[model samples]
Structure formats: C-alpha cells, structure tokens
Target: DAGVTQSPTHLIKTRGQQVTLRCSPKSGHDTVSWYQQALGQGPQFIFQYYEEEERQRGNFPDRFSGHQFPNYSSELNVNALLLGDSALYLCASSPQRGWDNEQFFGPGTRLTVL
Candidate 1:
C-alpha cells in the first residue's frame, strides 16, 4: 500500500516570498502533521490538521499555516519566507491524532530561501 507522499521534492524561494508544500496521507489515515528539519537538527513540529481543522501547533510563527482537505491530503503554506526557512519540510500521517498512534512520514520537500 502506498504511504504518505509529498510533492515538489525540491524548491527555491526568496525572502518575503510565499510557498506551499503538498502532502498526501497514507491510505486509511485521517490526521496529518507538518514538521521542519534544519540541517543537522531534528524535525521540529509545525502543526497538525485533523478533520480539516487546525488541531495543534508548535512554536512556529504565524507565517506557517496548513490545510487538510476532505480527502485527507494537506498543504502547508509559508508566507513572508525568510532565509531561516531553508529546511526540509516533512509530512507525517497517522490513523488518528494521539501520542499512541503511529505516524508515517514522507521523504520530505526541501525548501531553500535566499
């Protein structure tokens, strides 16, 4: 069975630009989480979407936003991008939102901002 998948494996943007990254959840999954991983750093949780609503978020600024579609796919939108935004954006999907639920992650979308 196909697992979570992301698009635009690589991307480049300039400061103050906006970018949107896509994610398709694994079959039978209904929750999606977004994370940003800087070089040599662990993935930092951005936010999570469930039932098409923003369920939880981390310390990320308001520039980071996301949406969950009826099909369980998602899109992460970053506005007014900064050089610090350069990182690998990861998407993870799980059957449900809970600490016990196992999440499957996509390879990731690398975003570089100049």
Candidate 2:
C-alpha cells in the first residue's frame, strides 16, 4: 500500500502568480483534504473532497480551490497568489464516511513566494 505523495517537493514563485500542487492519496482511500500550515501554526483545513465532490470546506478565500479526480488523487490550485500564501501545503487522506478517521499527511510541498 502506497502512502500519499506530493509533487515538486519544493516550489518558488512570485507574488501575483498562480500555482498548482498535486497530490495522490493513499491506496484504498477516497477522501482527500488540503491544508495550509504557516510557520509555528497548526494545519488549517482548506477543503475536503469525497466521491469527487467537496463535502467540507474551511474559511479560505476564493483563491484557494481544489479538485479530486476519479483516481482519488487531488490538485490544489491557488490563483493570484500573495506572499502570505507562502507556506507548507499538505495533502491528507482518510477513508470515506468516517469523520473520526485519522488523516494521514504527505511530506508536503513547500511553497515560497517572494
């Protein structure tokens, strides 16, 4: 069973640009969630997708959007990025229909905006 994987372990971008980060969920999982973790802060949930539909979402701007594919993988898209967007983007996976399920995180994709 493979664990979650994220692309471009690290990324650098300038303010006002757009970025897309990809994630592949763990085997046998159908739920994918995205989180943003600033330095010294706990992960903040962005949104969660199950069965290819968003089931839950957190308080984030419209700039933060995501998509889950049939393969159970997901992609997080951020538009008109700001310097504040610079943080660790984490992808978490859990079994479907289990809110109490423990989420497994990926190594994360570090984004640096200048």
Candidate 3:
C-alpha cells in the first residue's frame, strides 16, 4: 500500500521567496508531522497537526506554518525564505489515537535556496 507521500520532489527558490509543499498521510492515519532535515543532519520536528488543528510545534519561527485537512492531508508553508532554509522537508503520519506511535515518512521534498 502507498504510504505517506509528498509533492514537488524537488524545489528551487531564492532568498526572501516563499514556498509551499504538500503531503498526504498514509492510509488509516490522521496525524501528520512536518520535519526539516538539513544536509547530513537528522530530521528536526517542525510541527504536527491532527483533526485540522495544530497540536504541536517545534523551535521554528512563525515564518513556518502548516495546515491539516479533514482527510488527513497537509501542507507546509515557508515565508521569507533564507539560504539556510534549504533542506529536505519530510512528512510523517501516524494514528493519533495511539501515544508515540510509529510514523511512516514520505520521500520528502528537497528544497534549495539560492
């Protein structure tokens, strides 16, 4: 079965520009988490949303935002992009009813900021 999926496998942007990435959760999952992984670094949690409500967020600034749809799909939006913003954006999905459940990750969207 298909698992979590992300769109725009690759992206390129200039500093100060904005970008939006999309994701669809795995089957039977309603919780989606977004992560940012820099080169040679592990993924860092950005945020998680469930039931169309944002439930948790990490250290990222307000320039990063997300929205979860009723169908468990989600989108991550970044504004005022910087060169440091270049990274792979990941989307993971898990069942919200379970605590600390296993999250299935998408292939991620590689973003490069010039």
| Cα lDDT computed for each candidate against the true fold | 0.96, 0.94, 0.96
How far out, in Å, is residue 92 in model 1?
Answer: 0.2
* 1-114: candidate 3 lDDT, tens digit per residue: 889999999999999999999999999999999999999999999999998999999999999999988888999999999999999999999998885778899999999999
Report the C-alpha lDDT of model 2 over 11-109, residue by residue, as the tens digit. 999999999999999998889999999988999999999988888899999999999999999999999999999999999998886769899999999
lDDT for model 3, on a 0 to 1 scale? 0.96
- Residue 42, model 3: lDDT of 98
Candidate 1 — number of clashing residue pairs? Answer: 0
Model 1 misplaced regions, further than 4 Å = 97-99
Q: Write the per-residue lDDT of candidate 1 for residues 64-113, one digit (tens) a residue.
A: 99999999999999999999999999999998847587789999999999
In model 1, what lDDT does residue 57 have?
Answer: 100
Candidate order by lDDT, highest to lowest? 1, 3, 2
Clashing pairs in model 1, backbone N/Cα/C closer than 3 A: none
Worst 10 residues of 1 by lDDT: 94-103
For candidate 2, the clash count comes to: 0
